[model samples]
Target: MDQTTARPETQHQSVTFAEGLTLDCGRHLGSLTIAYRTYGTLNPAKSNAILICHALTGDQYVAETNPETGKPGWWEQVVGPGRPVDTEKFFVICTNVLGGCMGTTGPRSQHDEHAGQPWGTDFPPVTINDMVRAQKRFIDHLEIGRLFAVVGGSMGGMQVLAWAALYPARVFAAVPVAAAAYHSAQNIAFHEIGRQAIAADPDFWAGRYWEHGVTPERGLAVARMTAHITYVSEAALTRKFGRKLQDTAQISALGDRFEVESYLQYQGSSFVRRFDANSYLTITRAMDLFDLSADYGGVLPSAFAGTKTRFLLVSFDSDWLFPTEQSRAIARALNHVAANVSFVEIKSDKGHDAFLLDEPDFHRTLRGFLAGCAEHAGLS
Candidate 1:
């Protein structure tokens, strides 16, 4: 369960491709290992496959006990038998994305040609398109011709957009929850702050910390803490922690005086235990580089011109990170092209993390959307 170390094969299902992948940066990976988890049964026709992309820092333990954290799957609330994304009716496939630390070919993965040393920063700079390309290859490996749906939020939602735009014919329904077509300047600035924090750590070793017998956990933790703030709303934070003190007693200089401080500290510390610093650098770069509309001369509609895929875009009212306007822009683009698409702004106080939380309205919307799509797709 060491986040930066090689995880045993028993921890998850994986497949290695000898030819590897051609990354967006034009580097060729000789051997690719995709660690993934599948829930429910693939129908005989293989038409029920739903690729559930994970957000940043998430792994392939979608509906199982996470081997590293020993906690229920991140989406356990919505993706189980008799739940919203019912396993009884659909097959769910989640993979540890390229540039991730969890059993995938990433910064921590050994370079096949180089042998012992890890890829570290040498791992070819990955893009959102690159991540989706890897996922598409994995789906082909599973021998699934087309997917019933491609679903995700935040970073995962970016992947969903990439999937739909890159391979529209292969996706029957695309649900990008709490996502945008490109990285906003503010989001990029936040990510830059995180990267700076990691680099400032003396133990970072220019991202080659694996050779130094130490990890840049402090810097990584700080990055997590900073980013975690953007994941929730001020309203939610006030309701949960507010200005309450961690202890009623008078505190020392370095002591965590505020309850919020201690909470973020716990979050940061716990994150470093289950994540790798170098991989964090690699993945965030990928997220920051994502821009679905730039390829088509900044015309978002041109990207989906003549696309056959059905789209359902969801956003939370309080999600300033990937706000309602972003989703609306996408909706307008799809409308311009007369593509099948629906956009919704779910009422919630959870901010950007609303899709991952226990919001009944979000769950209902998802269930209803998928159900309607299933009927259209001839799913029983």
Candidate 2:
């Protein structure tokens, strides 16, 4: 599907909800506003609603303008008319997560009532469950009693699983791609390294420097560069650049002018221009603390004990960040609970990013799964 032809420039409304108070991770967050974009109209019965959860560094713009970068939406290719998501038939909605910087209430948002500046380090820590709780309020305000499906990848996928476990009756189906039920020790370690890198920067100033005309640009860039490398496979890096010099003619004794280094440098620099360091800390911390099974008596199957929500779990062959084993763990738990679930380990060399990239097999499976869901709901 051609996203340009399917998606029109549509207006989005800024919505807020008083979520009473969040008790997840021993933090209380009050009065949250979620920035969301919706496409298609809800039927009279409101059964066609589909919630899209965005990954880390992504916002409410799924198939439209990105407020931060003034660029096109991130997941345009797979989420439009005739696309796998089929926006024409489903009322697609995507929201900026609770700790997001893109228009949603987060650390970067102003706390003028308290200090006349951004919340920054003053913002209370948030978890994936907290993000899901905020999203539930948004759905309730929209008067959507149930969702056709909740779909996401990476951290977005974490939210999908959290939704399934937290609100089993409200979600009809879930597609958690390239995500794990718990944050692996390795993943948490990587996040800690990034956080430490940011904290070590003199300009960080415990996140208070954003309002003082100082940005931790270099720290954020290095963090992004480090994380970006984990998102792709070794094979991809080797194939794309190898040890090739950036400028073949200017090869000197000066170290590391390789194409890979140049590529990572560009990626890191571009990311720092739009993303906030504080927001990065908040979101990554949420991801690191995510452990759905821990709350369910350490029995992963018990988490989905009585849920009827269908699940479609997917993993890429080279996705070391959230490998095939993680997806299989989810599937095995669902199986142990006798829940309706399907698993697919797609053969891709793109690693964790395969979920977001062009993978015909993944698209085909998604189309089939969505069609099945629609048929079950009698929407097709």
Candidate 3:
């Protein structure tokens, strides 16, 4: 495999895993490719690199315009030059995770052994650790010894934790925001509903939608609507819509009448335009299978035993989906293992999505944490 790095300014690049990658499920990919993006510059010492992982539905476009959406990056406000991540001073890298749809090897990507056909449902189920393993390969391709920091929110946060635990020496600092060490039963149930919604769509064609030249748009839309509700807080919904009708002063239509309903409908419609239904199933299953304790003989603290990686865990006050309790649980485990850790729960009604929003306190907390980490790493 060619081990050359993409140009520093490359917004999107692909790295082929020619030796193929074996997933946790015992499925071996004959060949794999990872799509990624980079920002800022890697200093002479190469100690200024930061890996920014994305959440469940997010792709590699971190602080640049998304070619697919024709819109500014999802985290543009928080990751540009001089922002919290400080791209000007730190080289930032974000990759579309395994089982993602954005130009990465996923259900939508072509299968090497089967020419002109996508893996679709045949794509093996993946776990958070598998995603991290693939990313480690990507970093090795760049010839970087260790990352200055690994930062992510939600599922991305899970990846951060995996990096710190599985490759402690390779990470100097780790930040897992709005994330949990394992998916809760309620979370798994919600995901199951979404997956079922997609499967039930006639167009899904038993995960062979690609062959049928049709997409499971309606099913995917419903799934997005359900997942979007979990991303935001109930308080936020009430504040933003407050049972207000979409248009008239009184109720009229039977479907999507309220403002919140209309908003959810728009979100669902927009999501299907960019996401693949089979990819959604694969990724959500991976998230649901994440269990740090399982790898450590049912002892969660043992997972972080003797770890030297500095840790910063953040949670939102209203993020009931992956609430403050989950972050506190991780903090307790880290403390038990004598790990260096700091945890904070920001006061916000934005819920799990607060990490992506323009929350002043969240930004300040992140900026301070990264600054301290950079100083400790001796990166001027």
Candidate 4:
């Protein structure tokens, strides 16, 4: 987590599509590249694939030691040999999303149409559907006729839902954990605050800070701090840090020496080291624009009018960001369509981030659901 530490070079596994793709915004990216990592072997029938969609800040390292951070994969606890979404029995593929910094084609990637400079702000606006479409191209290239499962949390969960909606016949099971069918107003407000923080930094340079040979570290760090606060519950913050005071040497900019402030500062500093400011802006905006019901004339059930894809929607009790009520609403819509759906609101103190943590109940539910589907699919 050291800001001064030099991370190792990224060893990317990616494929380029020269045919390119047209974006939802009508912009065409010529020769798009998608970086991903696959764990477990693809079965001969190609029916064991399970796509892992990461959150806003997550990369493709779902079940291995991350080369850049040297840290264990994000979901290593729930995705190993005997875990919930066991890689030993499933071809687990995780991709750094379209506007991601971990080797995916994004705002920081060089513009093919431009004269080799990074796209920066010139990058065309993207939506959640665009991200799912991009992933579909990669899956088609891999010759996967259908994915056995699609799983994700937060923004990644949005992509999972989009995948099921756009290609219902392709996804046998869709798990959207700690996510909603649409971004809430408060969430959009939170994102705007972070975006303003980035823009307010003079170093942002209109999202072209790389051209100045400087990162908008201060702005990006503050933005991360803000978002991180939303990820955890107030009870968790109190339980972990209380009003505990940090040493005077670690006093914050506001002159407070609280332990929580120090922790958030550490998080922000570490995030800036691994994430791109423009990519953060791009992804958050995409999340804000996500409205799965918009395509169905605001009738949520109509979106899944005839979906055969089974759904498991997970929510955390303390997740104020995307509350259980939102998950319930989606479940109700799925029920209205008589689509196979199950919803579970996990009992956890860890707010919106409960899905990422080691929650036994959540894991049990996911495991049982996937196991049932695997049996139905005859994977066992």
lDDT of 1 by residue, 1-380 (tens): 11233555335567878788988788899878888888999999999999999999888998888876777899998899988899999999999999998888998888766878889888889999998999988899889999999999899999999998899999999999999999999999999888999999999999889889888888999999989999999888999999898666467898888899889999999998888898899999999999899978999999899998999999999998999999999999999999999888999998998888999988898899999999999997
Residue 370: error of model 3 in Å?
1.0
How much is the lDDT of residue 269 in candidate 2?
87
Q: Tell me which residue pairs clash in candidate 2.
A: none
Taking the tens digit of each residue's C-alpha lDDT, what string does model 4 give over 1-380? 00111113765777777787899999898867888889998999999999999999998899988887776799897787989999889999998899887887898888777775888987888899999999999899889998999999999899998999999999999999999999989999999989999999999999889889999999999999999999999999999999998667464578757889889999999988888988999999999999999988999999888999999999999999989998899899999999999999999999998899989999999999999999999999
Q: Write the per-residue lDDT of candidate 2 for residues 37-63, one digit (tens) a residue.
A: 888889889999999999988888898
Q: Write the per-residue lDDT of candidate 3 for residues 1-380, one digit (tens) a residue.
A: 53322323333567888887898988887877788889999998889999999999998899998876676788987898999999999999998998888776888777767877888898888889999999998999888899999999999999999998899999999999999999999999999989999999999999999788999999999999999999899999999999886565465556767889888889999999888898899889989999898999989998899999999999999998999999999999999989999999999998888999989998999999999988889986
Q: Model 4: which ten-residue window has the lowest total lDDT?
A: 1-10
Off by more than 4 A, model 3: 1-12, 248-253
Off by over 4 Å in 2: 1-12, 18-20, 112-115, 248-256
Question: Candidates' lDDT values, in order?
Answer: 0.90, 0.86, 0.89, 0.90
TM-scores, all models, native as reference: 0.97, 0.94, 0.96, 0.96
TM-score of 4: 0.96
Best by TM-score: 1
